[model samples]
Each structure stands twice: as structure tokens, then as C-alpha cells.
Target: MTRQAISSYKQELLDTARTLRQQIRAGEFTSTTSGLASGLMQGNIVILTADWAQDFLHFCQLNPVSCPLIAMSRPGEPLLPELGKDIDIRSDVPEYNLFVDGELTQTRTDIADLWNDQMVTFVLGCSFSFEEALQRAGLAIRNIDLGRNVSMYDSSLATTPSSRFHGNTVVTMRPFSPADAIRAIQVTTRLPKAHGAPVHIGRPDLIGIDDLATPQYGDSVPVHDDEIPVFWACGVTPQVAIRNAKPPICITHVPGKMLVTDKLNDELAIL
Candidate 1:
């Protein structure tokens, strides 16, 4: 594995997120937010018109594991004061994916031009929040060590529908030795908002994943021979849900490139 040296920072979670957001807003940080601004909450962004908000909200409620809704913005409001002091949804995220009629149309660094009074933004909890927890527990995350985006795949497991939204669950995978996998589950279980625990372990075939080497999203890292592949419910499940919903216009964070929020990771822990 090619390990990258991550710089050590003394700033607190809110300070870190604040500084990171500046870079993101300036179009300087366009890559995945994984392992960045550690201990702060990271969210998957999903924006849709008010007309489609209710069904999508219901879809999130139906699939809590994959779509743990955090803070949502009022229609036409771009600032999410509840999640951060002044989080501007239009430019807080490093990257955004615009989908039209179930097809991805373009990727944007900022969505200020697309913002409208009819649009509502949804912030879903992300697994990246627990990576810090795992590291605190002394487990090394392969994706962070390798400086690659976490591997994600479209699973065969179907999500419950809400009017127009319905699709398969998407899962993020991390390879670990059996012992570490067990510890990872325990470490992550405390962070319910961060996708909680492993949804599947050991057998990829059971989840209809034909090849671990070819993930549907993000870069694939090597899973060693002695390690088992561990899957966790991912925030990106909404993207699949959005594709099936087929709204005239939908916006989402490019998978892995998330919005760093000021909320602390420990604040999301149930225990």
C-alpha cells in the first residue's frame, strides 16, 4: 500500500471544518473529504425541488441505515445554520453531481447558479465520520493509508420505496483482518448517524458483487489475502434512489467528495 503522510493539525473540529470549507468554497479542494477535518461530521448532499422533497424525505425515513437524515434545509434556503454557523449549500461541498431524468448530466464545483427558491437541500450522515473513531480505536483504514477514496458498490439489497424513490442500497467496503473487522464493528456501532455497523462481512458474492476490484464508485484498494471485506451502509445510497426517482432535476455530492460540517462526530454517537 502506498501510504500518504497526512499533516497533523491542532485545530478543533469546528475550526478544521471552517478552514476546509474555505478551500472547498475557493475551488481548491476538489477531492474526497475522507480523513480530512477529522472528528467533525461529513455529510452527503442531496438537493431537489420542493415538489419532490416529501417523497425523498420518506425514502430516507424508510432506509435509515443507508440514508440517515441529519439536518435538512427549508425550501429556497441555502444556509444550514443548524449544521454549521454559515454553511452555504451552494458552495460548501467540494463537488456536486447534477442529474436530470435519472441520468447524471454534469459535475460542478459550485451550484450558486442552479440555486432557486423551490429547491431544498438534504444532509445525510456519512460513514466518513466514523473513520476517526476507528483510528482512535487503533485500527488503520486502508483508504486513508493509501490516500484513495473508499470503495463503494451497488448492492443487490433493495430499499423500501416512498412514492417515486426506490432502488438498491449502496455500500462502502473496507478490507480488514477478521480481528480488526470485529473491532471496527464495535468502534463504529457507537456512531449510529455514521451508518452504525457492518451490513455484510466476508462474502461479496452474497451481496451480488461480482468483483471487488471493480467498485461502482471510488477507487479500489487491495484487500489482502488474509483479510475479509467488510461492508457498511453508505450515504451514497441516495444517489441510486435519486436515479430511480427520476425527478426532472436532482443534485448530489459526487460520491466520496462530501460536505464537511461543524457538528462533532461524538455528538452523533448514541452511546
Candidate 2:
């Protein structure tokens, strides 16, 4: 894309994010943010108590590819001014998953009632950001075309541990022709914060994923015969870690329902 075209795309993204966030806050839009607000950064939300924050922070550091920590709020603070001037951790996300004792207990649209001074919010870079980059590069994302959530799998690849946080890496897969996959690698490589590039390509067995049609999380889209299945380390990896940690209370954005941020995707990209 040319410099002028890039600037125009970014402005459109900013406008979309601003409008979408208002709807999200009003409880009017409560679905997947995937393929919406293109060119803006979408984040995976993780909220925990101060007691578990340190260990969780360590978990992010140890598994940077899957859990790249982009912004965090101080203990007891629900506001993350770094991500957006209006971002409120307790209400910005479209949907939230509440976990207790390593098991998912409930899913909520807003966590205002659960917000406490003891709580801390962690925003991790999401693959959705790079999906936009792929689309801009003229690559077709099957999930987007199918109008469903991206396919996610629990891989055999274990992440480095940090205290009680340890689990297999979770990945998001996108099918592409061999030629497009190469272009995808080149495009995504520029965005490290977005889990930059595929970790595994062509073979699902190597990653211990038995079936592409049946994903461990999210809806599955068809992979054409000529296309290769490409996988990238996913932000949901921390949810697995949180489950292993078994903290007293944990909160995260529902998989596919991310927190749309004001930051531009290009801001997280490298030359």
C-alpha cells in the first residue's frame, strides 16, 4: 500500500473503532469484533486480583508470542488510559469469561459488579490486528469470508512456565494458498505484537490438532483442498495459563470477542 493510502485506511479504522466502542459500551453490540474496525488494534483482555497479577505478568513475559502484554492497568484500577482515553476495563469488552478455580463459571457482557480495587487488567496483543494486515495484503481470511469466528486449537506445544501458569500453546488457524501464505508471512512478520507469522504451516498433526473442522474454540471455516492451513500463536494461550494457575478469580474477554482499542495496528508494526 502507498503512504497516502495507508493514512486513509488508518483514519477509516479510527472512525470505525470510535463508533463501535460507543455501541459496545451501550450494550448494543455484543458479538465478535473480528473483521470489524480494520486497521485498529484489538486486544485480548485478562483481569485478575493483585495477588495473581505478578505471576500472570511473568506468564506473559515467558510466552511473548502467545501472550504479548501490550498494556496493563494498576491494581484496583479499571481504567487503561494507555490503550484509549475512554477505555474502561470493566465494560469495554463485548463479552467476558469469568473463571474460578481454573474452570469457566460464567460469561458476562459487563463486569461492573465484579470490579474491585484488588483487580488488575492486562491487555494482550491479538491476532485480529494481523488479520487486518493480511486482508490489506489481498489475502482472504476464510473465517471472515464465512462470517464466523476464526478456528482455534489447543496445540501440543507447551508454553514456558511462570509459577503456576503453564499450559499448551493455543493457536488460531487461517487457510491460504501456498503463494498467499508466503505473502502472509511477509506481511505479518512486520507486526510482532500481533503474534507475527505462522508457527506451524501445512501439517496439523505436527501441532497435535486432530481435526481442522472441529476446533477446540471458535467456529470452524472450510479449508480448500489447494490451500495450506497456517497457524499463529493465539492470545487465548493466557486463558489456558490462567486455568492452570487456578487463581481465586480470573476474567478474560470471551474468545473472538475482543476489546477494540484506539491504537492503530500500524503503531505495533515494524518496518
Candidate 3:
């Protein structure tokens, strides 16, 4: 536990997005948002100075699978009207990672003091938005059941480069039986905003992942002999790009922790 883990996930999981945001805004819930706000869309957050916003936007556009852009705020402005009526980019997420010169310098509950006229917040659609759909399709999400953050890895596959951002894609892994994975794919394919479907299936090594026990981000979950590993493009891909681009300062949601938005997942899902 890097920071203290929140209790009552089961009870709290049913909280509305606004309620959850209030808790997050108040600094009461600082753990992962993996299982909260069921049926609603969650977003991956990235805040950068005006100087780097355009290039980062280009990076996201180049790799839509990993960085599905949903909403963005004007420089120095903290409100994202598209996400929620009262969504404040400065304090709505549970935790934030502050990067200085491409290195993570600190994690904070809020970034109000750091917000400036040059800051721009970009919200990318998060894969957690599709978990309820997976459940509706009868697929089990392992990490949620195990009370842990999902496993994430850096693949050998490189992202399409932008003017100043280039790095390998970051992926989140979920293990499912052959039958369930097919259903999972079908269910998620309708929600392109949620990173869509699995990018790779089966052998982890083929994608350059050496082990399942250790991950680049989040907790590693168990993969049974009966199941295969399924990978999806993750929003954290931008964080990797940030490292390569070396911006003076950047603030992003800590991995697995996200901005739980007012919008419903069904609104973003294609029929």
C-alpha cells in the first residue's frame, strides 16, 4: 500500500459519480477508482502547461487506442463542463502525480496551488468505464474481485509518434477464459471511448512482457492455467510520453485512480 488503502469498497462502490467526486474532493477516498461509480464513465487525467499541451494532444490523437480523448479544459481553467456540472480538475480526482523534468516528484490529493494560467487539463476515456458492461456480458473482472489495482505493462510495441512525444504503449491486462474473453471483446468493442477491446491476447512474452508477477504499474493479479492474458491500451501511455518529452512540469492522475465523471457509460457506447 503506497498510501493508505480505503475501506468499504463494496459499500462505497455504489456511490453516484457526484457523491464519489465529493468524497474525492474532500480527500476522504484516495484509493483506486477501479470499482466505483458503476455504469458511469471514468476518465484518465493529464494536466500540462500550454507549451506542451498541443504536442501531447497530438500524441493522444496518434495513439487513440491508449489515449482516447474525451474532454479538455482551457489553459488555467479547472472546470470541465463536459465531465460534470461541478467537476474541478484541480481537486476532483483522488490523487495526482506531479512530474518535474520527466521524473515523478510527488503525489498529492489536489493541485489547486499548482494550477496556473498555462495549465491545461486533458481527460481521456478510462477502461474502468466498461467494467459494468463486461459484467453484463457475464465476464468477471479479476482485479476488482481481488481488491487490487489492475496489472499494467509496457509493451514492446511502439506508439505512433507525434512531434515531441514518442514511447511504447502502456497496456492493462485482464485474464479470462477463452470463452469469456470473446464475450468481453464483444461487449467492450461497442465503447471505443473506453479503450475499446483487447489489443493482444495470449502469450505475454510475444508483446515483450517478461513476467506476470511484476508490472510497470498497479498490482499484479493471478492468471490461472485455464485462462489467457488479454491486454488493452491504457491511458497511462501519456505518462510514458511525458518521460520522453521531458516537460518542465506535468500533473496526472495516479494510475488506477481516476476522475469519476457524471456521464454514463451507455452514453459513450455505440449500439
Candidate 4:
């Protein structure tokens, strides 16, 4: 595409992202953010009090693949201007999982009521940010085609510990023919912020996933006989860490849902 054409396309994507965020903030769109705002970056959110923020930040540093830190907000600061104009962390995500002492108490559309002076928001890079690239490379995304959330599993693979945070890594799975899988890997390797490449390919059993039909999170997607399941480190890994750490209060985006940002996905790509 020519520069002018590409610029127009990207502006459209930015407009879509901003509209989606507004809908989310207004409690109008609360579904999984799998296929919307194509060509833009999406993020996984984790909000914690100042007391637990340092440890969680360290945890992200230790496990860069699962928790690629993109943007972080200061305590009690709802705005993340670095991500986009008027990006309100508290109300931008479609759905928020409220955790109390390591247990999910409820799902909320907005967290403005819970936001306090000590709360800090952490935005992690999400694999969803790379889906548009895969499609651009002529690969079909099964989960998006199926119009369901991507299947996610809790792998026995462990993340390196940091202070009080420790837990198994969570991964997102997508099925592709061997040839397409290779191309998919090549396409995603450029976006380290989007978990880079598949952590595991082929057999699910090797990764401690007993059955793909029943994912620990998100919707189940079938793996065709000719295709293999490709797993990438997921941003949800922090939820497992939160469970282990048992912070007094924590908030995160729902499993399949995420926060859409105005940044173009290719802007973060490594050429």
C-alpha cells in the first residue's frame, strides 16, 4: 500500500479503537475483544495497590514473555496518556475481574468505584495485538473466524519468581496447518511485545493440557486433525501470580477481554 493509503487505513483503526474504548467505558460493549480494532494494539490490565505494585512489576520483569510490560500508571492515576489520548485505565477494559485475597469475587464492567489513591495500573502487551499481522501474512485466525474468544490454558510451565509472586504460566492456543504455523511464527517473531513466537507447538499433552476442548479460560476452539495447536505465552499469566500472591485486592481484564489502545501494532514491530 502507498504511504497515503496506509496512513488512512491506520487512522481508521485508531478511530475504531477510540470508539471501542468509549463504548467500554460507557458499559455498552463488554464482549471479548478478539477481533475488533484491527491493526491496533490491545493490552492486558492488572491493577494493584502501591504496596503490591513493585513486586508485580518485578514479576513482569522476570517473565517478559507472559507479562510484557507496555505502559504503567502512577498510583491513583486513571489516565495513561502514553498509550493514547484520554485513555482511562479504570473504565477502558470491557470487563474487569475483581479479585479479593486471591479469589475472584465478581466481574465488573467498570472499576472506577474501586479505584483508590494507592491503586496502580499495569498494562501488559497482549497477543491479540499480533492477530492482525498474522492475517496480513495470509493466515486465518481460527478463534476470530469462529467468532469466539481464543482458547487459553494453564500450562505446567512455570514463570521465574519475583518476591512474593510465583505461578505457572498461562498460554493462548491457536490451531494452524504446519506450513501456516511456521509462517505465523515468522510473522509474530517481530513483535516481542506481543509474546513474540509460540512457546510450544504440536502435542498439547506435552504442555500438561489434558484436553483442548476444555480450556481453563476463554472459549474452546477445535484443533483440526491436519493442524496442530500453537501456544503462546499469554498476558493472563499474571492472574495466576495474583492467585498465588493473594494480594488483598486486585483487578484484571477478563480472560478473553482486553484494553484496546490507539497505538498501531506495526509501530511496535521490529521490522
Best by TM-score: 4
- What TM-score would each prediction reach against the true structure? 0.95, 0.96, 0.94, 0.98
Candidate 3 — worst ten consecutive residues by lDDT sum? 2-11
Backbone clashes in each candidate structure, one number apiece?
0, 1, 0, 0
Clashing pairs for model 1 are none
Q: In model 2, how large is the Cα lDDT of residue 250?
A: 95
- Judged by lDDT, which candidate is best? 4
Q: Write the per-residue lDDT of candidate 4 for residues 1-271, one digit (tens) a residue.
A: 9999988988888888888888999999999999899888899999999999999999999999999999989899999998899798888999999999999999989888898999999999999999989999999999999999999999999999998999999999999999999999999999999999999998888989999999999999888899999999999999999999999999999998999998989888998
* Candidate 2 TM-score, true structure as reference: 0.96
**Shift in Å, residue 82, candidate 3:** 1.2
Task: Tell me the lDDT of model 2 at 216.
Answer: 90
Candidate 3 accuracy as lDDT: 0.90
Stretches of candidate 3 above 4 Å error?
1-15
Q: What 10-residue stretch in candidate 1 is worst by lDDT?
A: 1-10
RMSD vs true structure, all candidates? 4.8, 1.8, 6.4, 0.9
Model 2, 156-249: lDDT tens digits are 9999999799999999999999999999999998998999978999899999999999999999988889999999999999989888889989
lDDT of 4 at 191: 98
- Which stretches of candidate 1 lie above 4 Å from their native place? 1-11
What lDDT does candidate 3 reach at residue 20?
Answer: 80
Candidate 1 contains a number of clashing pairs equal to 0
